[model samples]
Target: MPDGNRQIVLTSRPTGWVAPENFELREGTVPEPGSGDVLVRNIFMSLDPYMRGRMNEAKSYASSFEIGEVLQARVIGEVAASKNDGYAAGDIVFGMLGWEDYSLAKGAASLRHVDAELAPLPYYLGALGMPGMTAWIGLREIGQPKAGETLFVSAASGAVGQIAGQIGRIRGCRVVGSAGSDAKAAYVADELGFDAAFNYKTAESYLAALQERCPDGLDVYFDNVGGAMLDAALEVANPFARFVECGMISQYNLVEREGVQNLVYLTRKRIRMQGFIVSDHSDLLPEFMAEMAGWLESGEVKYRVDVADGLENAPATFIAMLKGENFGKQVVRIGPDS
Candidate 1:
């Protein structure tokens, strides 16, 4: 067993964009599991866009990460010690742990055993986890896509967008996606079975691109990158279109968020634009997991992962992810699976 636990702490809050300097790595004594507590040695840690919002002191759906405290994230770990009856040493578990080598899970609510034989441990943090669940709930409940209808997803090659686009295809919708690069666009269209995709970076105009690709107009818009993309989507939306507002990565770092100019189209077209937090829809997780597991097993849905080695690299990896440098779902490998 390791003598100490390593953790990343938020040193300062970012004014605009997050920097590596905002974080500090510290080593401390490994925590021991008390009664009803389980000590887990983390193997993987998920880095997501939502964490950006948590950095700020302002209130949101989740609480802010306090400075000088260990950052929290969805982590997959192996039980190192256990005082809880439900868990034992050598058990693989998934939970909301911290950005550290070892975490002490207090109760059953904090951890759940994961089957390593079913899938790779990392998949529990990506496709079978929060990102996958986000895609499922947002598309099915909010987007409400129909067969032969047109669906457009912004940030199409991203964690949520990739799964959302595939789900749209399963529903028999013509799925169109917008990515940051030509390669990413191609991967979404060719590899992930998107009907059409465009590189938003090189496109002459978002409206023109959408017009060219989605000639029939969009019936559902699974929005991830907002700003001008959201405006363009609104302009090309059909009457009674459903806009599933997932995340706005484009405006996350900006001091002033960009306003949508084509919102007038929303009223004219009778569009329904609804934003959601994935945790609020946990009621659907059981159904989602059953369906998603089948799709994955049947090769109907595919996923990609962008892994960064070591907990020390998490700060830089997180910054790059915010800038769209990551190709897929970004996660950190803190320790070996064994």
Candidate 2:
């Protein structure tokens, strides 16, 4: 059995956007596993932009938070003790754990055992996990990017965005991406093989910047930062273009959501703009895992991570990620393997 536990809880709901004060740190003795449950020691806890939605007491694809409840997240852990038949001590798995030093795996259905030989454990939470699945489905299934098409992605250096651009490149598309800084832009363009990249923060105007990179026209837009980037993409979209709306980090902290003035351009371009949640594509997870694994093994796809050292920093990491401070996928290291 585990001897110690530390965790982060949502002490208060954020009125408009998340604040550091909303999180509270707590510690206690780790409880032992019971029948059908496995006591797991957390190694890596994932911090993502989606956690912001969970901070507000509002309805969305997932449930909102209640004050003082421990925030939910995905974590990779090793079984310290187990009463479950399928899992035993020292087995590594990833599941919907939370911001904690220890967690109980309730059952085997959602928890997936991982092979570290195949990839690093943290990769299970990033490239081989939800974010990777998101990029795959958004590009191939929703956007349907084809060979020679011009593709654009916002938040291009982020976990999902980086993967999305790589997927676009793999499809033989001419890909351009926008990031928050020059360094991030270079990471996408030079390291990630984006055809062109720009720092959206310094770009005079969104439309002008996108037009400069995609002069011919954008055939597919994998939108991560919604507001101006979406509006700009709409302006340069060719006839029959597709826009996969994955996330909207640009307006996430705004008290009032920014309205796009160029939405009318979508009509003229006959663009198909659609929003998607990853749960909607559960049927494709197995297929995506197979393909992404192949891509990883062959070095066709690569990823980066900005990891914080403790669970107590989860909130700060999440808030920073929304502000474009994190260079890659943000994750928190909670405890060491037993």
> Taking the candidates one at a time, how many backbone clashes does each contain?
0, 0
Candidate 1 lDDT, tens digit per residue, 15-43?
89999899999997798777989999999
Task: For candidate 2, give the lDDT.
Answer: 0.87
Q: Show where candidate 1 strays beyond 4 Å.
A: none
Measured against the true structure, the TM-scores of the candidates, in listed sequence, are 0.99, 0.97
**What is the TM-score of candidate 1?**
0.99
Over the stretch 1-338, how does candidate 2's per-residue lDDT look in tens digits? 54668878889877666788989888877877778988888899888888788777678998887777677889999988889999988999888986888887776547878887898788888899999899998887779999999999999999899999999999999999999899999999999999999998999998899999998899999999888788878888999999999999877778899998887877887888888998888898889889989999999988898888878777888888777899988888887754
lDDT of each: 0.93, 0.87
The Cα error of candidate 2 at residue 50, in Å, is: 1.0
